[model samples]
Target: DQQVKQNSPSLSVQEGRISILNCDYTNSMFDYFLWYKKYPAEGPTFLISISSIKDKNEDGRFTVFLNKSAKHLSLHIVPSQPGDSAVYFCAASNQGGKLIFGQGTELSVKP
Candidate 1:
């Protein structure tokens, strides 16, 4: 069974708007959450991450939030630009560092 899931397969946002990507996990052992952005023909690069101890973490235009009780997490990109359009994958890992990834959400930022 898939431990991580991205309910929405895709999301569309206007440039300069906020883009929100969501993910849910069934494994309570997961204590770390990470978001990766992948462009076509390229490997996924780390975007942002959060620990279960913290509810939110922010970096420039990106933010990651974790809801430990709900076993849910989200990544937010503010003022999204065309360059931000990509496939985003959410991953979770426990102390062992074994990562479980969501299917990924393709975000389209329209200019």
Candidate 2:
């Protein structure tokens, strides 16, 4: 069974607004959670990450929140811009260095 899951396949937001993406996981052993943004023809680039010890982590306009007890996580983008439009994937890794990714959620920012 897939350990990571993204329930929404896509999300749309107005520029300058906030975009929220949701992800869930079944594995409790995951210690690291990451979000990656991917363009159409290029590889995914790391966005933000949160360790199990922290409830939240922020970087510029991106923020990642983790709820260890619920096995859920989310990414929030404030003042979302057009350039932020891309596929976002949630990844989880145990101490083994192997990552499990959820099906990506495509984000569209409207101008």
Candidate 3:
């Protein structure tokens, strides 16, 4: 069974609009959550993250929200730009830093 899932396989949005990606997890042992953005050939790069202690974390145009009670999380990108188009992955880590990743969500930001 997949411990983490991104129900939506892809998202399309206009530039300067908002893009929201959703993810869910079944493991309660996860204490840390992270979002990563990947390009065609390059490796996934860290975007934003939130510890179980916080409900939200933000940086620039990216924000990550965690709802522990529901075992859900989401990544929000405001003013999405063409350069923002990428595959985004949601990941969760246990205390030992072992991570579980959801299926990636391909984001398309059209001009």
TM-score of 2: 0.98
70: Cα error in model 2, Å = 1.1
What TM-score does model 3 achieve against the real structure? 0.98
Residues 1-111 of candidate 3: C-alpha lDDT, one tens digit per residue = 999999999999999999999999999989999999999999999999999999999999999999999999999999899999999999999888889999999999999
Cα lDDT tens digits for candidate 1, 9-109: 99999999999999999999898999999999999999999988899999999999899889899999998999999999999998888888999999999
The CA lDDT at 1 in model 1 is 97
Candidate 1 Cα errors over 4 Å, as ranges: none
Candidate 2 Cα deviation (angstroms), residue 2: 1.3
Residue-level lDDT for 44 in candidate 1: 96
Q: Distance from true position, residue 47, model 2, in Å? A: 0.9
| All models, RMSD in angstroms | 0.6, 0.6, 0.5
lDDT of 2 by residue, 1-111 (tens): 989999999999999999999999998999999999999999999888899999999999999999999999999999999999999999999988888999999999999
Number of clashing residue pairs in every model?
A: 0, 0, 0
Candidate 3 regions exceeding 4 Å error are: none
Better of 1 and 2 by lDDT: 2
